[model samples]
Target: MVQFRKDNILDRLVIVNDSSSEVEGEGNRDDHNVGTCIYCPGNEHLTKPAVLVLVQKEGIVRRLSDTEDNRIDDWCVRVVPSSNPLVSISANGTYSNKPFYSEPAYGYHYLLVASREHCRPSYIPAEQWSNVLVALQDRVKWLYMQKGVSYVAVYMDYDASSGWHPNLNIVTFPYMPPLIEQEVESINRYINEAGLCPICNIVSMEDKSPRHLVSIENFTALCPWAPTYPYEFWIVPKRHGIQLLRMTQKEIDELATMLRVMLGGLYTALGDVRFSMIVHASSEKSRKQLHWHIEVHPRLVDKHGLEDGFGVHFLSVSPEYAASKLSVASRRELAKLVGIT
Candidate 1:
């Protein structure tokens, strides 16, 4: 049985799956070969039937799904179940007690294919990115309405060497992640003591700071005061919104533009570096205290013992320097992409 096991004394949790050891050792050998790229268009049979497919014809976009016998061929974006899921919906809910406390790892894992083209540039076009976000919002809203779902985790893992197509992972969890829980607690504490949202205040304070990168219509991108990785930055909504579902159409477009410009800048500045993009938000119960944002962490350096074991991060480039380097490139890229200049 695949189960979530709580650390003996700490708040940490681990997914224990006894059967996955051998398969996990095989590594991502197939990920680097485009000839067998399952995510590429016309290879729908290589993956599970798509749950959501977005197709554009004559300037009109339609949302669709795939059945076992049919698959949409001209889809701009697609979402399907992960072939190797971390958790399963069919998990039996059995609980163990005391020092060996455990619960079934019950949830859904999905992969959102970002585009139709294979071997494309690091950053997709802004319009395509918007479609990706729209599909994501659709999936996340549906996931939240399901029974026993406490959180929906959205993130992307990209490495040039992996030869994998561009996609984002959507994972549903029955319980809140420890880091998110801590963030919610901290945000609530700050609100009670200061009578204002900490993120909103950060946006206001950093608007003109050296750490500021760029600001599009409804979003602003900036380097955090303390970063866990080199050249790490965050894209935050200017207003105090707690969920992506609350975003307006205009806000979504702006966010897509922000993503395109920032990612293009990262690629231009550092080439095809490995990175992770994570979306952090509050669950329904804690929405009032938390704000939603996206964080981009470039894995330029390896984590050492102090970082992995002691939770202490060492950064070579300061936020100010990183922002200064990224701002000029991103602005130029934005101008070329959307005529923002």
Candidate 2:
């Protein structure tokens, strides 16, 4: 955790406690509860019931089959909503708050109970990942065809390092969020004035709403410019999108493929790093903009002082060199990873 005592700003302090310990958090872990995490390879029956299942049979040409419609004894990937939530996010349908966060008595906050073995998304069998891709698209369509739906997103947070609290947070709010244009503009402004966000040159050069640059076919790595850590790295979607739940099965499949390769790349470059994945989307589908993207943060050091004291980060390596070293689809890295070889 980024040590809260020294340099963290008030808003950025996310007090994530150890879930496996005997210590209990103050708030209720049941109200928004969807079900058990069930991400580990063994406990399949303990999870929230699967609302949707996309399976892959051995003989299938292009693995795309819905098992949710029929009760299937055999299944590859399953989807279930969260039983309890830490940070509230919406997915699949929009709900209003009679108090706030409350919507039409029906909100969608499901989870994608990935396949059996406990590997990260990058390591999950390509076939299972493909099933998830198609299942997510089906979920989005299921919500869109229904009433009172506005937006959707496919999210997952891998926490084996955090005690295997593994699950995806698929959210659909009552409304859409603002596009990353504001983010881009603000980053651009910071770069223009102070030469900050130096890595943003990548964005400035192409300047497209949804850029199509891969991390490169061979290199699947990158370093962040305004990283909040010593050797913090970022895995961002090259396209400009906000709500990724709207993506098609093919798109989701591609996302899964790239993500798998990237994870493998990380392992190849870094010895053993703990990381997290986050997905954000544009509000109400944002036809005007694309807000689809993801971020991967490898926890290298216990961010004790720098981030806790000032918002400024003490990056230990150059982005270019880190990228080259990591040897992923992208070329970027920041601090502590090693010198920009």
Candidate 3:
């Protein structure tokens, strides 16, 4: 979280808090809310009731195919409402259109717990990751149909070194966000100038460039040329899909495999580095012109005054070098697994 100071113009800070103070029984180990791990299996009561659950059977993962009347105790992944939500669903879907630019923050906030155990993405199995993505796609499709929801933001902040849990936040907004708006404008401008989608062109160009890291059947990962942070990389689908909901089941499986490999590579290369994995998709207005992708920002360096004052970013290592290192690390890590290599 980047914060500004009213007292000093150049003063800025990145606040990194693992848990909220409002969480009930946050520190009591005997209450089953043990050690900041309310997302674990036994602590389901600590959070909202599970809206969705996926379970594994004989090495295959599937949604808990049980009647709503019967609840299940075993689940590989669970989706629940955030205890401290930034927004909530309103019955009337009403807003206060004031003169000073204000409105009601009414929307749904859900947390997709990827695992029953407390671990990072690097340690999660590929099957479980696939289940998480399937659940995410299902939830996003449902959230977009809500009364006041115009856009859904999906992101994960995994800083296991600081005891942060690995979970994805799905927050709906009543209107299009500013950053997404800016991205759509840029994509439109690029299409007009180049006669093609910039990201689709990037998928082709990066695969042939020195900054290329890995390429699966449906997706390819590369280090962006002008990254805002060090070791920043992007994973884009080879097929031109506008939203994650449009991905096929095979695509989701392939994506999970790529995530596990790339995240494992990062873990091997940089010991316990904190990172943010953000998904950028097309808004309702720009669905046809924009392509979806994932951006990874490894928190390896600090953001100083120069970065905050201006929107300029400085990188200590070049993307070509970073890609080469990650490529080697991925290969080395994959070799350790039985049948991966």
Candidate 4:
């Protein structure tokens, strides 16, 4: 007899048919089938009803509470369930009581389309940028209250090309990922030894070091001292906050600008380099000492077998050098766009 089993490691993971090239190149933007742009305005019915949407009217960004009948002109930002979700919404199994080998992958996954029209997040119209950030924060707060969801991860994928449209995704996990747990543990140890937050200390040090790239009123973007990959940069809030949902409107606006500037800089420095951006925050329990930040990883180099097998990474670009190059590029591009001297 065959038995049904629930496993996290080997089951419930998302599978993508990557028939095309893995490394995204400038010319590869046209590789995606144009007819299958399901996220486009006219293709609203192709996916699930939007959970959250933000619209602009009279120069004010507002949320569309009613999503019964979504239209193309109804919203500027849309958040709907993913067409290909890695985890299911159904609570199939409870927390495992056993020492643990198998358990159901119970979670929530969502797709956040920043603009109704196909466009990159970095180059979105200045008016709608804040609305996009607001949509993400609203959805994150709602997902946390969901059953079996202990952690939430929000990320965006950008291709430095014209044909492809970037999208942001939010996924909730039943348990904290091992990487996050390890980071928390390290933070705890550092706090015990130094009587302060390591991230805050790093921020202060970077502010005074060459690794600093851009420093805004509320946020700062810097190149980490020891990045796992080349040109890996992080945009962190100066305020000591953990839950991203707790940020005020002004703070959110600042973050949106910072993201736009940093990403726009990358676009200027490296013509059409695809990159991944992720948001990290502490859970309710760990909110006291943890800080929330956004990490941007540019796909400059591929990881070799040794890096994967031994859990080590060899970066070709140093953090200081990368920071200098990115800084100049970001400043030049932003000044031209915003008319800043």
Model 1 lDDT tens row, 265-301: 8888788888889998988644446688999999999
> Please, what are the lDDT tens digits per residue for candidate 2 over residues 236-316?
444433236556555665566556555656665775466666554444434433324466676676665667766456667
Worst 10 residues of 2 by lDDT: 1-10
Which candidate leads the pack in lDDT?
A: 1
Model 3: per-residue lDDT, tens digit, 5-52?
Answer: 112332221112223434442111222344556765665566667788
lDDT of each: 0.84, 0.48, 0.73, 0.71
Q: What TM-score, over all chains together, does every model reach?
A: 0.94, 0.60, 0.84, 0.85
Ranking by TM-score: 1, 4, 3, 2
Stretches off by above 4 angstroms in model 3 are 1-36, 59-71, 90-99, 162-165, 284-288, 333-341
**Which candidate ranks first by TM-score, i.e. highest?**
1
How well does candidate 3 match the true structure in TM-score terms?
0.84
Q: Give the clashing pairs for model 1.
A: none
Q: Which segments of model 2 are wrong by more than 4 Å?
A: 1-45, 59-73, 86-107, 141-153, 162-166, 174-221, 229-251, 304-310, 328-341
- Residue-wise C-alpha lDDT for candidate 4, range 102-196, written one tens digit per residue: 45556787888876666565677545667888888888888888777788978877765555555687878766665676678888789999988
